[model samples]
Target: MIPAASALARAGHEVLVACVPQLVEEFTSAGLKAVAALPDQAECWAEITDTGHDQVIKVVVGQRLLARGYPELRKVAAWFEPDLVLRDGMEFCGCLVAEQLGIPHVAAPSGAVNTLAPAAIAPLLNERRAEFGLDVQDDPLAIYRYGRIDSLPPRYSFAARGIPRAVAYRQPEASDRCEPLPSWITELDPGKPLVYGAIGVALPTAAASRDGGKASTIPADPVRALAALVGALSELDCTAVVSTGGVSFPRAGVPPHVRLVEHIAQPLLLQTVQLFVTHGGYNSVREAVRAGVPMVVAPLFGDQLDNARKVAELGLGEQATAPSEIAAACRKVLGSSENLARARHAQRELLALPPVDEVARRLALLASAR
Candidate 1:
């Protein structure tokens, strides 16, 4: 997402990124000034690891840190005086700072937030709003102070809550949109049955362990499960495009037909592929739906399970708890007329909507207008 911001900066905008300290170097490399914030990555990690009898302990620590750092955040915002303060939703300080500075701010959600009348955090949100000298409102929907900027369809949240669909944003063919795949995979025979497999971005490399133990050839046991899914695809004579993701495949033992690469550009692959097997991350599901590719999701943790539920409920995809079931699910989707028909219909609906860039532009426009 910072990369997207960098692209915008390249288009002749003055952009100052407010992020934790560790990300400063990477942001600097991309030619943006960085504003380091309180509760840096290490502290956040400590909070994550701070588990014991009292679950509220972490929250207590977080509140203390945030309270201490609010002044620093205000100082930074005053220094930058940005035309628009685009923020990740999780950063409450940014919102407060933006409000205090009387600057137009936009909520660039990293993932889905509670779209309802603030039921998920009504008490907390209300209290925070009061602290910021905002009015209390009965309508939960009115709580969204800054307009939302998201890649997801508005239907994604509205339909989940039984509301009528609002027209969503669309992206035009901007040169800055995700480019075509590198020439190598672009030439693959699009006619063949392509099965694209992926885990997500956050997982550790299978080779690197925290304990510094012998780095196994396969970094994590999850690969074994992923490999099992591949074997199942081979059983059905499907061409498997397995993304090993920085983990080397055993040279002598790889299947003859499966092509193993570290990564295949996802948006491009989705265009030509018949099936997508993925970890059900929000980005993967959104991309697959945007491309209209039916998915077989293997959820690991967090909102992935919820995402998988949405896929299955919408008839856009199927889910597998164990890796062994992936192949059978693939075959089911491939062989069943009902599954194929449902998937195609879902794809058609998704593709007709606008692209993500247009969505961001609309959000920025709406936020600035407010």
Candidate 2:
């Protein structure tokens, strides 16, 4: 999303990123005008599991966040008077705001957000629409009325039917400086393959206990999962790098074959990595695809399962859960030319699409017409 915002700003568009307080600094650091207009949603997502069955579909963002966020968004929109609204795929408030203002808006692709069933989410959003004094929309695709942007080709998309699809455009490498890789990473076992494994920051690593901040809020025990992956990677013949999202790792036994660090330049590292062991976050999957790297996907929850299934379906890699299964998958994937070929094919497709700068140009044309 930072890449998208940055692209628009570079194109001479006046962009204001309205996000929660925690993310304000990061957005401003990117050289964009950012404000803390949205509410803190940690507690909202945590309490969602107890809600009704219909409400469970869009767990992360729903009426609760919408109620708190829409007012803020409307206030900002009234003054900013944006010609077009670009929103995260999971965010519903922008859709409602666009509808109220009778303007255009587009969604950026998200792993699980695009996969949400419109039939399931329509009633939920329409309820809010009616309350806002807007006519209730019957069209399931109203949320994406102007369409959505995607890095993937149309045929390779994970979004369900009726989600207005955007033309395929290359998603940039985010262009942000990632935490530096330890200097010794390139020095290890040059003749053998290099494997990179990372579970996203949303979940807690085994080392999260040492960080002492927000680790308790994570509902699942990702530490055991991380430990299993570390254990498996330790025995593999290849050199391995695992990122623990800035938390201290392995209280004692540190193996030479593997390196556990707080962070690394993921976009750059993916280019050299022979195989990626991932928790199947979409951004990670997208980066691997852009790099033409094969994957061993072990999805923990949510849309990760869907993304993993898409990986397997595309012949890009294998999916596994258990540590032994992951180890087996890694060995098989590393040895397979087919997986590598498919991955490269996806990369070529991504490369063929217009770059994000060009996409920004098209978006500007659309906004001007609006």
Q: State each model's CA lDDT, in order.
A: 0.60, 0.80
* Segments in model 1 whose C-alpha atoms lie over 4 Å from true places: 1-14, 25-33, 38-71, 102-104, 112-117, 123-143, 156-167, 171-192, 205-228, 231-234, 248-253, 336-370
Runs in model 2 with CA error above 4 Å? 50-61, 175-181, 205-216
Candidate 2's residue-wise lDDT over 161-256, tens digit each?
667767678876653466655578758888999999998766754236335554224544566667877887877899999987764456467587
lDDT of 1 by residue, 179-209 (tens): 6666756556556677888876644342343
Measured with C-alpha atoms, the lDDT of residue 108 in candidate 1 is 59
The candidate that achieves the highest lDDT relative to the unseen native structure = 2
The positional error of residue 225 in candidate 1, measured at the CA in angstroms, is: 4.8
Candidate 2 clashes: the total is 0
Q: Candidate 2, 267: how far from true, in Å?
A: 1.4
